[model samples]
Target chain A: MRPVEVGHRGGERAPRSTRLLGRHELPIACEADIVLVRRKARSLAQAYGFDAFATAAITTAASELARNCWVHGGGGAAVVEELYDGTRHGLAMEFRDTGPGIGDVEWALAGGHSTTRSLGLGLSGSRRLVDEFALETARGEGTTVRIVKWKRF
Target chain B: MSPIPILRIGTTLLCSVHVELDDALAERLQEDVLGTIERTGATGLVVDISGLETVDSYVARILADTGRMARLMGADTVLAGMRPEVAATLVRMGFPLEGVRAALDLDHGLALLAHGRSGATEGRRPGRTAP
Candidate 1:
């Protein structure tokens, strides 16, 4: 019922230092929420001075990652962060879920190999679009996927 | 808010999916397309995604599934007007448009369904392009 009941405890330290912008959340319960994530991520990337292709890549990756959080991970949350590593600015997203975690990390990221009749590009496609990507998960434990896309000078 | 508009253009059902597709909207569309097929005996369906440049995997699945569902009920489905960037994103993402009969443009989708209404070549699956 309460999709976004995760309490907006968004702003934290560490990432705030390198991530020089505000934090936004995408409360994923249903499909429409996925759309919201895409738009929000795109806008954040634009605000950080990413180009057209970079913007598209960011939004597209956001959409896929958010969908995975909701669809495969049994409804979770997405956090978008504006990052700046001093010289270059960037965008980072963290996807978290309490659902069943992935079994094989390698298999899941192999592209077009979904067990749920999906296009199977969520993990691999998203990784390719961004500058950095990391995944942490166990079978019973939840999953957390963090990705970052930095703007080019 | 009104559901996505399903326009009756001649004997074909034209659905322009320009809005950001949520799960509920996609399900509603599936139901409407199938219901319209039975209600109007329409021979073809065209879902225009030209206006939409971004979509997730779930949205793509819904479109593909909608096409497959329409086929079972004797109606052909043609997904039309995907931007090049969107197409590139989809391919790069590894989400195949399985079971989707595609047209590069809306007019092509309409033509593909209009002239090729045999309902016999449903299994073969040939793509169409607008002239």
Candidate 2:
């Protein structure tokens, strides 16, 4: 018999790679979506071999980002990806929305900053949970948040 | 997601929660806890959160409100098994949960509730029972 297909048809799995693994587009109308997003993050993190601590951190970060999408953006979607070729094993999360973009990115990134009566730890706290965090927003272009976390010993 | 578990021991109701107590869970928890109190006529409420990973301001408010609700219904509320990290987060978030009775474990909470009930009943009218 021919050699079994052990790896992808192309060849052995690449040592390090990046790919968009999943995307979720849902109306942030109801409260139930919060739970759904959190569960999805946990599943993705587990499938990618994220350690328990990393899993919890990523889940919390996702919660904060998804909450912003719901409360500030009116609604948005998210994409979760794996970036294996980075300095370390990495997971990248992107949340995008078409609502009114934040005017003061610096102020918003400051700890204890929130437009709503939230805990006021959204952006800063989430940033602390990851290795790299970036935010991009424009007056009419909406907002996007990208976060990356590396696997650690 | 799995729902939190509610346990009944005598007239006390113990609720063990495992998820982050955000706005969504807080709203759902308020309804469920209140409904259980009403249905069972529980005399005490104990909320155990040792399994919780995080909590926000809204959740702290909800928990305080739950305690207040239980008190108004003639039941005492005690918070049990709050993890250190969760407690630190609450403090940093500026949520005041100090007045609510907190215990190190469920057994300790139950004992405290039992003692409080006994103390309330001491030297009281023979025909009346402490709530």
Residue A3 Cα positional deviation in candidate 2, in Å, after optimal superposition? 51
Candidate 1 regions exceeding 4 Å error are A1-19, A26-32, A49-52, A113-117, B115-131
Which docking band does candidate 2 fall into? incorrect
Strongest candidate by TM-score:
1
Q: Which ten residues in a row have the lowest lDDT in candidate 2 chain B?
A: B120-129
List candidate 2 segments past 4 Å from native. Answer: A1-30, B1-11, B18-25, B34-43, B50-61, B64-76, B82-104, B112-131
Expressed as tens digits, the lDDT of each residue in B1-131 for candidate 2 is 32776778889999988766668668788888888899999999999878876554456667878899888998898888876755654554345566678777777777778878877532233333579
Q: Give the TM-score of candidate 2.
A: 0.67
Q: Considering summed lDDT, which 10 consecutive residues are worst modelled in model 2 chain A?
A: A1-10
Candidate 1 lands at a TM-score of: 0.79
Per candidate, chain B TM-score? 0.83, 0.83
